[model samples]
Target: MNTNQKTIICFCEDITKEEILKAIEQGYTTANEIKRHLRAGMGECQGRGCMPQIMKLISQKTGKPREEILPPTDRAPIKPVPLGVMGKISKGNQKGV
Candidate 1:
């Protein structure tokens, strides 16, 4: 186990810096590859919480600009639905969707 586990990079996914580094060391250099390997930016925060730092790490490791290191596949953030809300929403949107 890596002692640096507490050094969390993706708090939403509980991903550690060591895990990201290991993924990078194992040739998962690109943002998508790193996402697939270690799930850094696939958390509830939708990469907002951790992608900056992850990109920074990648930039530092490979001498790439942080702006050049793209994040994982972008998606809408997850949100909690109240009870029965999803059913109502889907039912209302069925014709439109």
Candidate 2:
């Protein structure tokens, strides 16, 4: 998927703007909990792309400051690297060479 067209909100995994609002209505106050319950940011990218948009939506809906919303967990593999790169690194390295 092209980066520009990609959305910070994931709609395909049954995550909708309304659903996020509903989760807020249900008192789920953290993005982590929302990720667990709604699977909105649980896809392959692991929510790196969608969390910001979700936060914006939350801030708008609840009248809460954006800073009050917890930031998303920043895991490794920042960019989606090809497995071929991993394979090359592994094969080219030798123990105690």
Candidate 3:
């Protein structure tokens, strides 16, 4: 494959290989760091589709084993919720919107 080709890693986030490389060049070498810098793994898939590619890129750029580059931490509220649900909760707690 052409090294300069724009490979899409995070389809949901529209992240590309060049973007990932730029993140690495900017010292975002770990997957989590790249995630913070580029929002590569914060899309609808939530790293499921892009993490492997991100890890591979980090490993290749940093000369670290893939396993050594830790995955981004998965936090609570793993799935998104409707705004209406949040609005209802807020209304119940306070007098005003």
Candidate 4:
């Protein structure tokens, strides 16, 4: 690894500072926007680990307050699950469905 390389921001998604900077340069100013553009917060941890860092970066780069950079919209299945479990649920074998 290069000595000057930025550390990994999102371990689950393998996002780095350079990638986030590039996305910001491309006009993704908000946390949600950057997530969508770079898949930074869509990983298994669901941004639990890197959201604060991302928010800070966005705030610093865009001159916005940390509170102003909203977090990404959380969807159903907040926790990570095996793909096969989702397949079973989709197939209607889920207990309630």
Off by over 4 Å in 3: 1-4, 83-97
Best by lDDT: 4
Better of 1 and 3 by lDDT: 3
Judge candidate 1 at residue 88 and give its lDDT: 82
The per-model lDDT (C-alpha) reads: 0.79, 0.75, 0.86, 0.89
Cα-based TM-score, every candidate: 0.73, 0.64, 0.76, 0.78
Top TM-score: which candidate number?
4
lDDT tens readout by residue for model 2, 1-97? 6544433367447576667878988987678778877888777777766788888877887888999998667665666668998677668866633
- Lowest summed lDDT across 10 adjacent residues in model 3 is found at 88-97
RMSD (Å) per prediction: 3.8, 6.8, 4.6, 3.2
For model 4, give the RMSD to the true fold: 3.2
Lowest lDDT sum, 10 consecutive residues, model 4, at 88-97
Of the candidates numbered 1 and 3, which has the greater TM-score value?
3
In candidate 3, what are the lDDT values of residues 1-97, reduced to their tens digit? 7676688999988999899988898899888889988889898878888998899989999899888988899964577767898778677967554
Candidate 2, residue 39: CA error in Å? 1.2
> Where does candidate 2 stray beyond 4 Å?
1-8, 81-97
